[model samples]
Target chain A: MAKKPELDDFRVPFFDDKGKPAKFSPGEFDPGAKPFSSGTKEGDRERLAVIGALLDGLQERLHAQRVRRVLLVLQGMDTSGKDGTIRAVFREVDPLGLRIVPFKAPTPVEAAHDFLWRVHAQAPAAGELTIFNRSHYEDVLVPAVLGDIDADECARRYRHIREFEALLADSGTTLIKCMLHISKDEQKKRLQARIDDPTKHWKFDVADLDARKLWDKYQNAYQDALAATSTDYAPWYVIPADSKTHRNLMIAELLLRAFEGLKLEFPPAKDSLKGLKIE
Target chain B: MAKKPELDDFRVPFFDDKGKPAKFSPGEFDPGAKPFSSGTKEGDRERLAVIGALLDGLQERLHAQRVRRVLLVLQGMDTSGKDGTIRAVFREVDPLGLRIVPFKAPTPVEAAHDFLWRVHAQAPAAGELTIFNRSHYEDVLVPAVLGDIDADECARRYRHIREFEALLADSGTTLIKCMLHISKDEQKKRLQARIDDPTKHWKFDVADLDARKLWDKYQNAYQDALAATSTDYAPWYVIPADSKTHRNLMIAELLLRAFEGLKLEFPPAKDSLKGLKIE
Candidate 1:
């Protein structure tokens, strides 16, 4: 039997694709890596089915245990397959125990309160699985690069988020953050596809290009934020997201490993039910 | 081509295996209708798959329209298949566009504010779909029967809910509310199943029994709530949910009908990308 791999062993292929060592300084890093191919061969469908069955079992165990909630945060650039990864991995799980919260721009009420207020309300209850499509990390990544807020405020939020997640961990929530790292070329292709296909044109936002222009700055912010915040309790997993299949599999594997480590047990049946007549 | 079925022709079934009909007002009603089994055969997986495809198509159309929002409100008794319907119908949807918000007991913050505050915060954005596993109907149903609030308060909330939904409709958000109806015996069987199966024991909440004792009161509350709130803009679809398969298909068909009415047009692509270079 193969030994279980450590969480750190999860490969992030961005640096290798650039043919140079990637640096994480207080400044920008040039974009690297091509789109990762989803290794969906002919038999891949069968494998996914098997994985789906396993997921059902895992979900049951998690619910039965009534343990701490599990929060899976997926962050990525456009077309990074955040949506696709979530659907494929969690497709078989029971909806009762699963919660998906996608954070968009702050509304008037949300803007009035702290940035984390809306997010806090959406956290999962016990024995549930919550997925955040884009999370509080945006306070650091987007605002820092867009100059929407000052650098000092961004730095302050980075510290606040680390503490916020640590508190959730202490309160029985397992936070697993995944950054779907896609390449610039892949993003361009996807954006073009959205424009070319009338059915997909609604997904294309012209404003996203403004962020693309400052992509290097955003990369620096992400690197700084990850380094500052990834803790033993709530670590970041940077998946090679260029390939939708690979990203989905990697996420599923990460989740499987997390649940496996929790050692969840099913609650025993109440004996009183034996007297109840089903007929 | 088959003729379109009349809305009145949709009759849901109920059952009285344990002779529990004596507990409620006397009326000649089919207790063993099992209305959910209409289009699908017994024990067929295709029912769920077909619903899943319809949900996926609806999601795609909803997204392509750039219509930021859609809301699915599910209200049901125990074993009414709220969880099953949501899972089966939305199993294949893009998670980015979907958000499932389950309303439970009020938290400290929720209690501090008005009831609608928390719910309004979770409303879907443009190009998104939001599901309320249980929702603001509690403001009327629980209070009306339990007398936690007076009749005037309940009546006021009924009007408020209608106005709220109307506001959502006017804002271009499609609101779909479903009430899952199940017989008392079916509820008992489902509750018993939760207690009998060790794997499902965790879902057996003691509070559920308290609600079961007030089953008739709840039915009355539901009838009143639906009658008062169902509007042309956001009509209620009271689905027969005794069979999980039937509930899934019916809900999916309703969703398909809703999306089909949108007549979503994809945005035209700009030719400006012709000069963009990918190095």
Candidate 2:
């Protein structure tokens, strides 16, 4: 049996000044530094390929184990590379076991239900994997920033989310939450690029800048959210997202560590499914 | 550019033998003599591995393209390996870009809304991958078999589904629907195994056998569902799933072909991210 990788082994620091946790602001983080590249000095490309191969192996083993579920929740501001990160890290994974859910603005019907109702409906089953581009965090992030709910309601939700996640973990599901951190200047440049490039025009949303205006509010929400909710069972990894390549490499490494610890093994068949006389 | 694999190359004979274009009926077709060992033959194992590699590659490329989304829906009867198939085939995929939504008994909220409401909420974003363990097809299959709704209502859903799928395709989402076909005897034995094995008891549901009693009706529903909905834009693949190894191999091959044809490429990076200019 392979020993579990240390949790610290997968940790990628997003903020340079980590001595003070609460004081770490997104703007204080240098978006231009290639933190991931710094770590990848030892053959990053080869490590990526190896991670790809290991993921392929894990997919097959997970199939035989018949545990068909993993949920990966990614939360970040614009240019955090939610799309880019997913493409770079998971490019090598099988489409069958993998499912990606991107949550947008809630429809009128969604607004009618308890916020978690829509999210629960989409949770992955055992023996499968699910990804949430933006998830129930929106209940906290959006509502907190927009004052959609009172401070007390948001606080109550923080406890509710911790319980919700604990329930999932106790029920044989592994929850990996990630917060992609990018600086405001980098976000502005990325938003500008989307406008300047015709191919990317489809991705630009005028409303994104509206969200940017409330950057401090969003950051406070994230800090409070992570501090209140990050647990031993389901922890949060804050990946620096200024460099797309670095972001991809960091996310991939974290996943590789998680899968390695799953202790997945192939389920032995009653007999090899060979030569069954099927007349 | 690599040549795209033709759809016909991955077609299974069982699909045609059960009377193509006719309503599906359980036990209507025989498990013809084994053409080859159903177990992972040497060639099959290598092919499975290759398929795994291909999926990983496609996932990354698709993520890069950031314009296309893929939805894979797996539907089948009890003990038909919907869960098993997903785990085994997609185990190697990156969890970031993939999402899995398993449609179970509808909640009061879901039941209140149109069936597609919950589904559309979980649809993949551009450059993401989503899987539905059971999908909107249940509106047709479950209702038709249980007489939950009148035949006219079920018939109406068939048309609605075709239009729904067409819309998905037109919106840059590629739809791959699969029905896992398992024999009654095989199902009984598996159910027995679940009962006999303590670790497996959690998976058994007495209600599954209740559905088993009405097997033929479910089959008829599936046939109608497939015939009416399978289209040029979104096609359905009926996989031979009695043998787990064979089922995994077939599903993997089908996906490999779908992705190979996508011609996915990485998006260009912004000049700012291309290389850092250190001060």
Candidate 3:
């Protein structure tokens, strides 16, 4: 029998690591694949809840320690389930510790600065688990596909991103970036469902169709950006997002592992607080 | 059957409203009373869920219209369930629309300004449903209980609060203030439970007990403040909060009625995009 696939199997290979250069293509992995799934839907949901409980414990420890920080960057096409994933994965986690930063289109003031400027300002501080719903990657992906930035400029921006992320990593932030991979067919179904349900129409904007028209270019832009920036310091994972449950479960499992890797423990019972009765 | 209790029955009577002047006492309301309960605990939980669903829809309309704002201010002594109330009441509401702002002890910078300065900055914007876990009421209550402020000064502060709330209401904001009323015995039990559990110690400060000892002073401060500030625009409600389920249900029902009062509706559909298929 074949050994089951591991999470690293889905990781975008490390870029330019010493003597271990690697590569990735957005198309190389199947968005519909459930390699990380717990087989049945119910089983996957149960696994997600277990992971959620574990994440909650880890998050509380993270807050208590008030030292280490975390940044989870999620980038996906419209309807790839960034909001849904957040709502589900964090169902059990205390909202106080989980900060969700959804970066919409830049305002005039934000557009005035270097792309990294606004992104830098929102980076998680100590003892935070911050999720970037769409992030600095938007500065790279949106412009590269729109022909507002050439290949050379895009390469320069990627290098800047690598350095910015490295600064965060060196300063005690553990970064995990996931690209919510979804197929064109999946996008069509999701978009149409939103259109058919007027209540959901609020979540949709007609401009989303404009993005769908440039799907191929955006896909290539994502491929280039992920391949160029996936480093051991800030690894990128291609989360198969065609299935909502699969996407949520995989992300929760990845986060659980990342948190477990932190070896977080509550601050040693405060000696000053020991057996001190409240007056 | 006894006449069904209405939400207004719990409302602190309006202060200084022409010939209809009224009075209120925090002691007059029993914290153990389940005036809004559905009799059985299970029935109360089901009622809470139904109200929660109605709030979710109303919140969606509030967001879609992007015209009106709602602010729910929750205040109580330690262990009065402000955090728990938010969690349960908003369990079904979209997180995007619900913004929970927990105001802690004022910082040096915050303390530098007039009491309402920091609070005014956090007021709900158009199309928002904002919750103040503890609010400007803290300014009046804490100082009055500590005797740092004289009665005349406390009364002045209460007047300032009424004016500030009036500003919010006049600016298209709907205000709902709930004082989660719990008994001193319940407070002792809750505080002791936190002390017994080291994990929850982070949420409890030893100083909290210092305040607990002044419980009567704080209760008197609350009575004075509520009587001075409860207006038609921003009336206060004394919530019997010993039963967590009932407190949640009562708040949910109050908000549902408030939203129902607004008669929020989806913005008319866009005609230009009607029948325009995504290419």
Candidate 4:
């Protein structure tokens, strides 16, 4: 019999203490796979609602405790459903407790500093849950794909990223990074849909096709970036995201597990307030 | 026949272009009224959900057009339901398109600068919908209640605020500010409930009780501030909030009206992309 798929099966092999991927390649994951999805969309959505409510409660506990923090980083090519996953999975969560930060092309001021400079400024505070819609990974992927950065420079950045994330983990942050993987054919279809619908043009730019033309090179850059940065402190996962429902379900499950692993509970009752009454 | 309730009946009259509330006093509006409610909690929630979905779509158009901004400011005494109102009203809105800024007690750095320094930094950018859970108004209310600022200083600060908000309005931003109003007796019950619940202790601060002890003073501060600064550019509405359901419903109605008044529509189709095909 075929084995039941576990979420860990999709996690990129964590780099060893010496900083090397045990064994991994972005190409090994099938973007079209739905290993974690239930039989139908309706069933998956029902399941998601359950997890979302639990997440909502867990997130409140996180805020109430005010000790630990959570950081969820999502990276994907255009149309790979990063925005959709956030909208669906957090549908039941309190917007007050969740913060979503989207990293766009750096400004002139941002580019003047180290790439991590801007990202570090936006790190989650105590008792906060922050999502990086796109992140510093863009720094490595874009420049490397365009040959704007040399191989040595790319290696240095990977080291910088690993060190930066390690600092976050040591400071009581739990990080979950996901790469929403989609097939080349899926990209072609999604891009065409945006092109055919003129109302979507504001989201579309002629520059997007330039990136699509470099699809293979971009994939290679992602493979290297993921392999180099996946670590025990901040592990990266490849989410087969052709099916939007499956992608939201899988990401929500991963976050739920991370929160549960913290063994969170409400802080002990305040002794001063014991039997006190507001007059 | 009894007069049908109008949303404007709750509005703290807009300050003339010359800067003065036409005829307003926060006390004139009853805190326990349910003028916007459907007469039942379940009905209020259903109405909220309907408006939430509409808000979700309108928010998307706002982002797509990238031409306008929306700012919703929520203020109230402790236990007045600022947090609850946000959770309930924005429940169905796209989390990506919404930003919530909760202003706590100013930090040392913030205190050293003018009160609006931190607030100005957090103003909504174009195509964004931002909510200020507590806002610059806190600057006026807290200090005035504490007697830290006298009448002349208070008047000067209010003028500065009116001018600052006028700048935002002229910059293509729409502002709606609501004071969630609840009765002193209702507050006593809410605070007592928190004191009685051990698990809620983290949310309870002894300082909260101190503020409650000065409830009447704070009300006076809010009254003066609202009457001084309410303007055509940024209007203040007193929301009846003794009923949590009614508070959420009324705020949702006010926001929907502000958005509809903008007459937002999706940006026109791009002629350049006509007949375009992804190769």
Per model, state how many residue pairs clash.
Answer: 9, 25, 0, 0
Candidate 4 per-residue lDDT, tens place, B1-279, comes to 999899988888766655455766678889999997777889989999999999999999999988899999999999999999999999889999999999999999999999999999999999999999999999999999988999999988988999999999999899999999999999989988988888899998776788988988998888888888788789899999899988899999999999999889888877877888887
lDDT of each: 0.70, 0.72, 0.88, 0.92
In model 1 chain B, which range of ten residues has the least summed lDDT?
Answer: B20-29
Residue-wise lDDT of candidate 3 within A130-172, one digit each (tens)? Answer: 9998999999999899899998898899889999999999999
Q: What would the per-residue lDDT of candidate 4 be over residues A220-271, giving only the tens digit for each residue?
A: 9999899899998899999999999999999999999999999888888888
Give the per-residue lDDT of model 2 (tens digit) for B186-230. Answer: 877777666555444444445556687887788888877777777
iRMS of candidate 2, Å: 10.1
Q: How accurate is candidate 4 locally (lDDT)?
A: 0.92
Specify the highest-lDDT model's number. Answer: 4
lDDT of 2 at A127: 76
Q: Give lDDT for model 3.
A: 0.88
**Candidate 1 off by > 4 Å:** A1-7, A11-45, A60-66, A104-124, A143-161, A210-221, A268-279, B1-5, B11-31, B34-48, B66-69, B105-126, B147-160, B271-279
Question: Model 1, residue A213: what's the lDDT?
Answer: 79
- Name the regions of candidate 3 deviating beyond 4 angstroms: A17-21, A270-279, B17-22
Q: What is the TM-score of chain B alone in each candidate?
A: 0.85, 0.87, 0.97, 0.97
DockQ (0 to 1) for model 3:
0.34
Which is the better candidate, 2 or 3, if ranked by lDDT?
A: 3
Interface RMSD (Å), every candidate:
3.5, 10.1, 2.5, 1.2
